[model samples]
Target: MEYDVVVLGAGPTGENVADRTRAAGLSTAVVEGELVGGECSYWACMPSKALLRPVIAGSDARRVPGLRQAVGGPLGTEAVLAHRDEMTSHWKDDGQVSWLDGIGARLYRGQGRLHGPRRVVVEGPEGEHHVLTARHAVAVCTGSRAALPDLPGLNGARAWTSREATSAHAAPRRLVVVGGGVVGTEMATAWQGLGSQVTLLVRGQGLLPRMEPFVGEHIAKSLTEAGATVRTGVGVAAVNRPDPGGPVTVVLDGGELIEADELLFATGRAPRTDDIGLDTVGLQPGSWLSVDDSCRVDGHDWLYGVGDVNRRALLTHQGKYQARIAGAAIVARARHCPLLETDRWGAHAATADHDAVPQVVFTDPEAAAVGLSLAQARAAGHRVRAVDKDLAAIAGASLFVDDYRGRARMVVDLDRQIVLGVTFVGPGVSELLHSATIAVAGEVPIDRLWHAVPSYPTISEVWLRLLEGYRDGADGGDGTDDGADGGDGTDGDTDGTDGRGGRGQGG
Candidate 1:
């Protein structure tokens, strides 16, 4: 078989790359050994979010006085699992395959590896060998896998990764989560809300160490209040499970033992390049591929690496963004046209990968952030100011929940007077992230942002408060200050003790 482009994985990144190539009138082929929609569709994003929605909704309802009494019951676990099945198409990939067919891309079901240069060979299910040659480009979008530490007896313990945690038919009564990053915290949140007694063990000082310090603090507080035991500054020493289906006993570093029905290790992710025939191309196996701004692999114009394999932003949306850029670049190169301006935000450049990646963690009081955090900006040698405001001070937030506990912060570059990054940790803040993403990505100036006013009595009013705080500090001749004291300046009843009578009707 021959194609203009051959994508090595059928994940979201690969799918999008193939989509763009076929749209450019190029024949594309996608090969996968598993389901077509890949991990995000079946195991990571879809199933996890489906399991989290009801839990979050129930939490939100509990925060409202009138609705609190109505939700004082256990979740409909069976219904939620069934809906998750529906969202993942019951673990089938026929629909995704059809979508590829409709787009005129060939779907090959097998294990694919690079033979050499532009050549690929696939070993099919029935021991049949198929060779595919890419005329223009080959994109490796194999994504990543869970990285587990080499703990004694861990392999035989039948522990869960993100896959097993998200796709399990039944929730374990006792669940012990390892790691403190997004996967660990999120899975802990989901299982705890779904009626599991979750114990989250973090080897670090706190959760989400990469984000703002307050983010981890707030989440730890919420998780503790919600009946999950979050233990930080601890490491798992060993695992013992004589029977795969039986309970597992975990030994912590200080000889403390904890038993749980199931164990989940969300430590980290490693690139999926170990067995993808990177050796044939003179690239190291199991190593992350370095790519240019156009996502073409370093030193290989005809080879591209998108998604987690490239070591860019590891989020699904970021991968899709890179896929679009890489796809366009490939098509342009094949047409013998000058790659459309490779500058930042150019037609073929993935500028956002550097300074505008956005992420949302759907835990209680959902945490969303984009671009650089305060620490990151400081470390990068940027003169930045951080302005923070209490989310409960927003009228819409009061109307949303009785005592909405959240905070919003914006980091501004002093020289440019534009937002470097924004972080929102509160209820319903996920939807507000794109505004900040656009502001940072577009390099919108602070003065111009002030003119783009937020509506009154809305959670978005927090933006107004943040900007007001920044301006006030500037007017007072305190350049690049940290407005950490909720910044509203009213000073009266700022702790949300006032009744929620003056807010908008709905959240």
Candidate 2:
């Protein structure tokens, strides 16, 4: 089979690439080894969020005066699991396949690898071989997989990765989660609400070490208050499960043994490029494919790497953003267009991956942030200031839920007077992240942001509070002005790459 574009992996990243190419009249073929919709659909984003929604909803209700008494009961775990199954189409890909068919792109159900430059060989399900040649480009969107630690007995211990953690039939009586990133923290929150006694172990000083320090502190306090033991500065030594269907024993680095019905290793993610024939192209196997700002492979003009494999930003949305840019770049090159919109925030540039990547962790009190954190902005050598607000102090927050507990922060570029970053942690802060994302991405001036007034009484009022604090020079914690400490500001990161650490499972 010969096509204008050949795409490996049919995840959201791959799907979007094919979508853009097909729309531009380019014949595109997509290959997949698993479900068509990929990790975000079946395991990571969709099913995981389905399990967390009810848990968060119930938590939100309990905080309300009249609703508190009504929701004071155990959650219906069966219904939640059933709903999760439905959300993932019971682990089927018929709907996604149909959508792909409608887009006029051909789908190959098999493992695909690069046979040579611009050449792909797919091994079909029945061991049949199909050779596909790409005339324009070959895009790699294979994404990533869970990276388990090198520990004893882990292979036979039946330990859970993000896949098993999201698709489990029922919550275990006791669950021990290692790694305090998004996957571990969110799963701990979900299972704890679903009647599991959860013990979360973090090797770092606290959970979500990539974000602001307070984010981990606040989430740790909330998780502990909700009946889960949140331990920090801990590492797993080994795991043991002697019986086929029995409890697993986790040995800590400090020689402490803890037993749990199931153990989850949400360590990190490894790029899925191991067996994709990288060696055929003179690149090392099991290595991340580096790409330029346009998602094109660094050395090969005709090769592109989109999504998690590029290691730009591991979040699903950021991957899709890169997909759109890659698709546009491919189309432009194919048309012999001399001028590709390669400038920052241009049509063919994925600038958001660097400065405006937004992420929302769907825990009880949702943690959301976009752009730079205070430390990040300062480290990037931006003349910046940080302002904060207590959500409970906002009038809208009190009306939204009695005794509302949350915090908000805004980091501003002092010289430019534009918002550098924003962080919100509260019951429904996830919905408020996009507004902050726009501010950071657009580089909206603080004076102009003040004109974009927030509504009278909503969680969004936190925006107004943030702006007021910035204007009044109120640091929210200390009344002192926290300014830059001798930054050269010469080596600005030109590539649109967010320096945030990658914690995949599609984030």
Candidate 3:
């Protein structure tokens, strides 16, 4: 069978691309071997967040003075597990399949691989073979899979990857999490909150090595306080599980052995390109595909690589953004229309992938950031300055919790006086990230940002404090200048109190 577009993965990226192409009057067919909605729908994002939301809510309730004693108990494990199952649709894809039907895209339930230029071959579960040809383009949105380290005896140990960690029916009593990246930290947080003794093992000096150093420091402190053992600067040398159903023993580099009911290796991710027949198209298998701003594969105008396979931003939202751009580009090509203005922020350009990618880590004291960190900005040769503020000083934070422990920072590009990046680590700060994303993506000037006032007595007022800090620093003096409010330049009480003397502050 032939169509105007054939998307080789029915994940979020592929679904979005198919939707766009279908909307543009193209005949699109999406192929997948697994559930239609893919990883984010069943395993990674949705199910994980479903499990964590109640844990976070319980923590939030316990933080309030009047609610503390009432909600100090452990999470209801059975209920949480059931809720997670509901969120993942009990691992069913019927709803997603119905949505594809509504979108006018044909669905092929099989493993899809490139056979040749604009050609795909699907090998069905029943051993039937089918060929699909694309008249306009073929998009590879196969995404990625968790990459585990090659330690001795690891594979046979039945180690938990992000898949198992998120989808496990029951939480392990003792969970040993390996790696300090998002998957490791978040799973540790979720399992620990759900009554597991979680020990996080990281070879690096801290968690979240990609973000600002302080962000990791804050999260590590909170995790430790919450009764999770966080071990840094340690690598696993080997693993042994003589009995498949018994506990696994992890041997560390310095000869220390740790036993746990479950061991999860959240090391990293590898592109899912190993068996998609890239060799037939002159591209190496297992290599991340290179794509232009319009998501067209390098040197192949009819080939597009959207999502994690493209090696652009690995986040789901970013993949959808690329899908939109790629769909538009494909439609333009199909119609024989001259491509117009494919520059940054153009209708068919994925400019945000490079400069304005935003991510939120939904651990306790949610960590969110957008754009480049201070070090990244400096390394990129931008004249930048970083401004910091303790989130506890924000009035809304204190009102939200007695001892709200968090911090916020903004990296400013001095040459253009625009925000280069913004990082927020605190309770309920995830909602504040889009503002930073907009500022960075739009290149809003510092002087202009000063006029955009944050509401008084709100957590967002931290924006005002940040801008004030920048102004004070730009004036070349200590941040003690008197202001119209008859106060020092410091926005909040230095002693970490909300000035009401209700409770002592320390997150």
Where does model 3 exceed 4 Å of error? 475-507
Q: 1-507 in candidate 3: lDDT tens per residue?
A: 999999988878888899899999999999899888777787787778887889888888899999999997788999999988887778887777878898899999899999989999999889899899999999999988888889999989999988899899898999999988788888988999999999999898888877887787888998999999999989999999999999999999999999999999998888999999999999999999998999999989799999888877777778878888999999999999977959888888999988998988888878999998777776788877788888999999999888899988888877788998898999999899999999999999999998888887789999998998888787432222222111111110000000001110000
Q: Which stretches of candidate 2 lie over 4 Å from their true place?
A: 474-507
Q: Report the C-alpha lDDT of model 1 over 178-276, residue by residue, as the tens digit.
A: 988888888888889999999999998888876777787889999999999999989999999998778999999999999999999988888989988
Residue 438 displacement in candidate 3 (angstroms)? 0.8
Model 3, position 134: C-alpha lDDT score: 98
Clashing pairs in 3: none
Clashes of 3: 0
Clash count, predicted structure 2 = 0
CA lDDT of every candidate: 0.85, 0.84, 0.84
Error of 3 at 401 (Å): 0.7
* Candidate 1 lDDT: 0.85
Weakest ten-residue segment in model 1 by summed lDDT: 491-500
Task: Please give the lDDT score at residue 135 for candidate 3.
Answer: 96
